[model samples]
Target: MASSRRRPPVEAPIAALRDALARIDANGPVLVAFSGGLDSTVLLHAAADVLGAGEAGSEVESRRSLLAIHVDHGLQAPSADWARHCVGQSDTLGVDCRVVRLEGAPQRGESVESWAREARYAAFAGIAEEVGAAALLTAHHADDQIETFLLRLVRGAGLDGLVSIEPDTMRGGLRVLRPFLGLPRSALERWARSRGLAWIEDPSNRDERLLRNAVRRQLVPVLDRVLPALRQRLPQTLAALREERDRLRELDRRRLETVTEPSRSAPGRAAALSLCAWRRLPAASRAGVLRQWLALHGARMPSRARLAEMLRQLDAPAADGLEIRHDGFVLRRYRGQAMLLPAAERSCEGAASGFCLPLRWVGERRVEVPELAGVLTIERIGQVERVEPVGPVKPVGSPGRPGLAERWLQAPDLELRARSGGERLRMHPGGPHRSLKKLYQERGVPSWARRALPVLWAHGRPVWAAGIGCDADCIVSKGVRYALDWQPLRRSRPASAPERSQH
Candidate 1:
């Protein structure tokens, strides 16, 4: 059992809240993540004091308004009670409050702590978006930061992990502020007691089975007694680590931009890395670049051994369809380019290849092909001045693929489907038909991506391919024309998953 005595209260917590709120770039509604714990109770109180009672239209006078989001993960039986307590506390303070109850528990083989944290933040993000919040405040204090550092250190974390908690940072597009990072937990407890505030003690905090609980209970105290100055020194050390981390991150971003490009398969949703350019980087820089690239696609950081293995594989021959799976994503190397794709995309392509999507060419602007995970856009390019059957179509604009003649495109029987074997396109009138396999090989399209590239068919013959130009037979020397372009949906990623903390 832990002692219940509280230290003398100080004015530091309120000052810290004011400073933190002032630093945010935007001015709008702010949300306090209230957990009904001593740290959060103090944070909520301080927030209400600084930002006012958060009535409707309060933002008109005060730059920002306040509200409380109490996420009930429901991991314990008393979670509902804790939520009620948070609402009661918020109401007493005259702050608007909402209780979000999280559904489901940790899946098999998943960490309860990780699941809880991810689900909790996900819920917060949803509410913040709904309320148009500029920032979300958490009650992470100096002690929590110290605990984080020690946990990461003992777990063999790298510099990114060792940076511990950041005072201001973006998570899942939400600005998360930790005003209490500079204040000790004891200060919060003292403030709560001084004001006679009430809070809940999470029963799971006593469960040493959780690594964080064990560290806080066993290791933090031992370190505190052994080195009385550790708390002060550790924060300085962490701040320096964070500075170095930011510096390296900037350097890595510059280097990454040179080697990477928008994914030709799923632009905006995924990225493509040029293997040749990436290989030219120094060994140390390569790891950083790879880590950053994986992050853009929502992949958690790979272990040192795992990252090393990925590098080793990249050094090998550029094998089309080479895949390395990690955290619900598949990193694939195809056609001298490395791509990060959602695991589902890789697994389901085989089945999707055999299905034919039949549709009419009714002058529609876009056709959504869910099975192919992309959209087929047919844009009218106006009248074709002249068709050079012996040569490729003249460039009308960017993405200048040859246009399909509107007269020929109006045929009743037209379908869009994945590539089947032996498909060929006649590049020019009276020219020898070329196999799609050979054409894809010439264009450097990877075998894996070929299955999903939607092919437009008319009168039982392929008229146009998504990434490739249309058949010359489908073009007219005169009259209206429509260009074919396929845009694949952004590679899907898990919307809510533990990030930065666990894989």
Candidate 2:
């Protein structure tokens, strides 16, 4: 018997969404960042369907809590109506809805699209916190990923930036999940239509004045027509890039550890690396290492031109004492070491005029010298309390740090002051006293770093310098000595402060 048989329509979108939810298996309430757009509409519907439909037809026993949130950017005239539509949809689905209205417009020089996106995410995070949502779902699909990839590619992004979208990530303390990253917009439209779901059509999406809109309106259609298989193959390419990114991250960590050391002066929280070791790495791998190194020190990624210029200067063997300033931090190379220090907060004129103040030390363990942009740590070690030396004052070696005798500081005439020119330091026991300027040069200290290296003066003479060791005459061969070390304090660059352009 030849019976008329019809194939069931393919419902790939809902099946994919169900599979994603099953894999995620969130423990608590899931909140959807619903925009009333087609993609989000479909996602919200599927979430409510999968979660609202309990296992074994026991809705009361197996159903999970679901919520929907709408952010009204208030950019367009009909934004309020869209928000109402979103609320109505949520009500029909039996899901709780929250509407957040953004109050202000975009800042001057900021793109409207960028402003809207930032505001929307901020709203999502706030509402998620308010509602105690365990996860926040967004409807960023394969098309969005492709656009992001192309945009970043044209903007000179590296391997790390090429892989644009992820299945999930933590943003502003919210677990932001994108269940539709693998699904195309066509599939979402089909699903929405099949379920007779109504959605809002955002007119701004077709406006090509914005970069993303232009790409979607013009560039994407061309790509779709020219390369029909791109969407299918692009994910594979992105996957490869992601794998490389992960591999390079691990390699960079190991390499950074090998070539870097903590700043000798700032023991707890500063970074210093051997410039010689960094130079020895393969030319191709150097940029990745530099990016990772800078990132660890709280720096934003440098532009390609800036990063290239940095590499050029760093690779030059004769480039002594170079400083590359970026994003509230200064990267300085001195004495074969690269140090990342916080950018000085003082203005150039202010620093030049006011940095020479004489600071009195009253035997405090820690002395914060704002003028010098660092803190002085005076640590008293050893148990002996005697004023006299236990043994003859020995020659100060290259490695040892000479300590100041505690007895000498009993009355403590210690004063911290900037170099006044013509100051001399006898670093070794029998070594000739050299000018502080000559000493700094001989030690390969950069000029910019020298201005902040405070000298410890006692009784109108130079007794200790921050980077330079203790003067030979003041060295204590014995008893209860104070070890003097200075660490550069980390100060943030003021929002109004201008970053020195990297040429």
Best by lDDT: 1
Query: Which runs in model 1 stand beyond 4 Å of their true positions?
Result: 1-10, 54-63, 261-271, 317-321, 360-366, 378-390, 393-402, 405-414, 429-432, 458-461, 475-482, 491-503
What tens-digit string does per-residue lDDT give for candidate 2 at 333-388?
66667777777622331364334445555568888777667888888665433334
Question: Model 1 compared with the native: what TM-score?
Answer: 0.86
Candidate models: Cα lDDT each:
0.78, 0.72
TM-score of each: 0.86, 0.62
lDDT of 1 at 488: 57
lDDT by residue for model 1 (1-503), tens: 98899955538987798788877778679999999888998899888877766334332325477889998887789888898898888888788889988899888977878788878888888888888889899999998998898888889999888888888877766788899999888888888898788889988789898888898989889988999899888888977887788789779989999999766544335669988888889987988988888877667777789899888888787566578898777878766778877666666688776879778777789887777777777888877677555565332235544578886577777888788788898876888889888877766667777787777788888988767778888876677778777765654323342233210
lDDT of 2: 0.72
